[model samples]
Target: MTTHNTAEMRICDAIWSIGVMLDYTQKIAGFVTPELLDWRPEFPAGDFAFSLGEQLMHITDIRMWIVSQLGTEKHAYERWAGPYPGIDQPWTFRAGSHSEVMEALESSRQLVQPWIERPMGELSLPTAGTVAAWEKALAAMREKGEDTSQLEAKGAGTLGSALFFLLAHENGHRTVTQTMLRMAGAPVERLA
Candidate 1:
C-alpha cells in the first residue's frame, strides 16, 4: 500500500498554497477586454502555442482533470476515458466572448481549490494507464528549459509528478495569459 507523504504536500502547498490560486483567479478577473482575451502570442508552429482564449480553456479543462486524477479516492481506469467537455469548444472557449471564458475560468479555478488543499502525499499515481499523460505534461515543461529535474526524479509515475504537473499546467497558462495580455499593451495590474 502507498502512503501520502507530508513532504509531497509541502511541495504542493508551495505550488498552490492557501489563497494563492484564489488570488490568481481574482486578479485575472476583468483584467482584459473581451477582445484582448481573444489574443494569442507569436510562437512557432506547435511551440507553446495557445491564444489567450485557448489558454483559458486549457487551464479550465486541465484543472478539472487534475482534480479528478488527484482526488483521494481511486477510480477505475475506464471511468477516466472520454473526450473532456469544453476542450477546444471554441464556441464556448476561443470564439466565445470574454465574459464566457472568464466565467468558466473562474469556476474551474474554484473547483481546483479543495483538491489543492487536500493532502495527496500518501496517494500514489496510477502507474500503467495514466503515466503517459503526465509524461507528456512534464515533457512540455522540459521543452521550455524549465528544471524538471525534481519532477523527473519522480519517474513520471507517481502522484508527486501528477500534482506538480497540475500546478505546472495551470500556473503555466496563467503566466502566459498575463504575458500575452501585456504583449498586447494591456495593463498587468490586478483587476479584481
Candidate 2:
C-alpha cells in the first residue's frame, strides 16, 4: 500500500469536503417545496432573517462569489452579473420556483467544477502565462500610482484555501437552510 504526501492528503480532504457539501445541497433541495420557498420565521430580524428561497439563493450567490475570485483574469466583483446584495441594494434574483432554485444551484456547482477536477499536483503550480499576465497588470497599476489595496484584499486565491472557503461557506448556509426548513415545518432528515 502507498501513502500519499501531505499535499495529496490535503487535496483529498478538500474533495471529500466538497462531496459532503454536495450531499447536503441535494438533501436540502429534495425537501424544499415551491410553497415553502417564501416561508420565513414570523419573528423578523430584517434581511438577516432571509426567507427560505433567499437562503437557498444565497447558497448559490456566495458559491459563485467565491469561485469567481479563483479566476486569473477577473475579480469576483467584476464578474458578478447577477443581483448583488450590496450594503444598500437588495438581491434581485427571485427563487421563483423549486426548479429555478435548483437550476441556480447547478450553475454554482459548475463554477467550482473546474477547480475540483484540477489535478492536485497542478494546483500548486501557477497556470501557464497567468502569472506573467498578472505581473504585467500589477506593474502597469504601480507605474500609474494607482491604489492596489482592493486588489490586495482579495483572499490568497490558492486552490486549497478557496476549496476550504467553499466548504465553510456552504456549511454556514446549509445550517441556515436546515433551520429555516425546520421553522417552516419541512425539515429534512440529517445525512446518516
Candidate 3:
C-alpha cells in the first residue's frame, strides 16, 4: 500500500473508533432524564452547559464541515460560511437527535472515504466559489503573519487535514460527553 493509502486507513480507523465512542456515550446519555439537562457538578464545579443532544449534533456538524473541506484548496483555518452553529450554539434547524447525528456522520464518512484513499497527486486544490472565498480568508490570515505551519505540516490543505481535525475534535468532545454522563449518574467507561 502507498503512504497515502496507509494514512487514509489510519484515519478511517480513527473515525470508526470515534463513531463507536459516540454511540456508547449517547446510550449512556439517554439514561439522563430531561429534567437534568441543566444539572451541574458540585466538586470542581464547572457548568455542564451543553446537553447530550447538543453534543451529538455538534459532532455531526463537525463531521460535515471537515468532509466539505477535503479535496479542496480551502484551508481549514479559513471561515467559509456565516456563524455556523456548533455545540455551544442553539441548533435551530439542525436535528439534535442521536439517530440524526449518526446518520449525518455516516453520510459524511461515506462521501469522504473515497477521497481519502486517493493519492496526493490525485487531489486537486481548486479555488472556486466557496473555495475561492475560503482562500481569500486564508490570505488575510497569512497577511497577519499567522503561523499555519502546523496545519500545512499535517496536510492541512488536503483531505488528510480533515481527517486529522475530525479525530482530534471528536476526542476532545468525547471527553466532555463522558464527563456529562458521569455527572448524570450514568455508568461511564474510559474511551480506549
State which candidate has the highest TM-score. Answer: 2
List runs of model 1 lying over 4 Å from the truth: 1-22, 42-49, 72-94, 120-159, 189-192
Query: In candidate 3, which residue pairs clash?
Result: none
Q: Using TM-score as the measure, what is the rank order of every candidate, best first?
A: 2, 1, 3
Task: Tell me the TM-score of model 1.
Answer: 0.55
Task: Report lDDT (CA) for all predictions.
Answer: 0.60, 0.66, 0.53
Weakest ten-residue segment in model 1 by summed lDDT = 73-82
Clashes of 1: 6
Residue pairs with backbone overlap in model 1: 3-122, 4-121, 4-122, 5-121, 5-122, 125-159
Tens-digit per-residue lDDT, 82-191, candidate 1: 34445543233334667767776677666656645555553354534256656777889989988888877756455556556776666666777777777888878654
Query: Can you give the TM-score per candidate against the true fold?
Result: 0.55, 0.70, 0.51
lDDT ranking of the models: 2, 1, 3
Q: Between 1 and 2, whose lDDT is larger?
A: 2
Tell me the lDDT of candidate 1: 0.60
lDDT of 2: 0.66
- In terms of lDDT, the poorest run of 10 residues in model 2 is 72-81
Write one digit per residue (lDDT tens) for candidate 3, span 67-106.
5555443323322123656765643433334454445545
Better of 1 and 2 by TM-score: 2
